[model samples]
Target: MADGAPAAAATDETALRRDLAAAYRLIALEGMDDGIYTHISARLPEGPDGQKRFLLNPFGLRFDEVTASSLVTVDESGAVIDDPHGAGVNAAGFTIHSAVHMARHDAACVLHTHTVAGVAVSSVEEGLLPLNQWSAQFHGQLAYHDYEGIALDLGERERLIADLGAKNVMILRNHGMLTCGRSVAEAVKLTLNLERSCQAQIGALGMGLTPRPLSDEIAAHTAAQYQKGYDRIEVDGRPDPEWAALLRRLETAAPGYDA
Candidate 1:
């Protein structure tokens, strides 16, 4: 039994571990991770202690190289409560994730990535543009935070939260991107969409062509469609069984993600 296992468990912790691990690999495949720069974390189930913490990737491990047992558990205060595998986690990662987790209850899983497109879009003067379907989905829903040098300062948490507001997607100006979801799958999906959106935008921009922008009404409608679409398909109605299948595939390919 794992260190956090209970005598009679209903939920399978191993499944969660696998899901998280699969997410890491998927992010790597999508080119969303930047050489161990980003982090993904899932909130653990509530325990007797009421801490109800999370598990995050170990520091220095490349996204593709991360395994389930390699994750480290920590409390909201950024302190490691369990380090059985001795997989060191980054203090900066903890600082960002713990702040969001502590401030927002809906943020069950927080994902951050530093891809070329994401960083490029973040640094753009206008931020994300609603020129494409992928970009339009984030219209009126994206938050922006100014870069504050490496995210190591504890004081940045409050401002980060303030900038995030109620949005699910955030662009760290001159930095990268952040997305929060009720589950690891949803978070991963959001990040994937965001990355693709940025990539598409950048590709379009490079052509030296002025792209057509969606009207405010259309952008709003599209954004609502995405929010409701994800809720109905990915979140509530099991509309995305493929994501579950992908998780299984990940287990076969990289078996120890959920450990």
Candidate 2:
């Protein structure tokens, strides 16, 4: 046992740290990060003391500075349980992520971001339009939560959860974007698709040409195919080939994320 942790638990924690760190680095590489703000968190498969805790980037480190060893562990309440650098978590981050983690047991990882494209679509009244293939992926799978200030109060957690019921992606009205998944890779993939969809919508809207949307039948069919990982090669039921290629790219461009 490592540090009194069972062998299985220790292994799971190690993998989570490396994967979460890699996610942060990938997001930074894509220019989706907003300095030290925004967060990507993974729930520990087995937390210390047998309680539910998650791994998040330390509050002070930039995304590029985050590493597997530097990630902090916090309970569902967002209280720090283990932080090698003695750093705290952002309060607003805690409020938002904790609500999802507590409400959705299947959500092993949660990714949130603030990008120009994302915020632009979020502020609009109609939300994400099914104007492109990327947008179609979220046809019936996305939800929206009206913004309620800066998300500092614990009282707002219920509303946040309520608004996000059974949905994997959410637009935080006037705020940004949020996505959760059963793994770090899945969460990151969702973030990438959502961000790209928002960017495409913004661009389409900018052209002043009325963008034609996919019909409801086609959109729903496309969404179903996407859920099945259609039109792409897969390994072990995930887009492993693409994910592996991404990791190779990350290894050259931004090394040591898994340190």
Enumerate clash totals for all models, in the order shown.
Answer: 4, 0
**Highest-scoring model, lDDT:** 2
- Give a tens-digit lDDT track for model 1, residues 1-259: 7865573343555666667888899888666777876788888877576876788877788988887777777787757877656866776767888888888888888999888999999998899999888888899999999999989899999999999998889999999999998878888888888998999988888999878888999999998988887888655766577587777777677665555
Clashing pairs in 2: none
lDDT (10s digit) by residue, model 2, range 74-113: 8888788888878888756778898999899889889999
Candidate 1 worst ten-residue window by lDDT:
4-13
> What C-alpha lDDT values do all the predictions have?
0.83, 0.87
Q: Indicate the worst ten consecutive residues by lDDT in candidate 2.
A: 230-239
**On a 0 to 100 scale, what is the lDDT of residue 236 in model 1?**
72
Quick one: how many clashes does candidate 2 have?
0
Local lDDT at 47 for model 2: 47
TM-score of 1: 0.90
Query: Judged by lDDT against the true structure, how good is candidate 2?
Result: 0.87
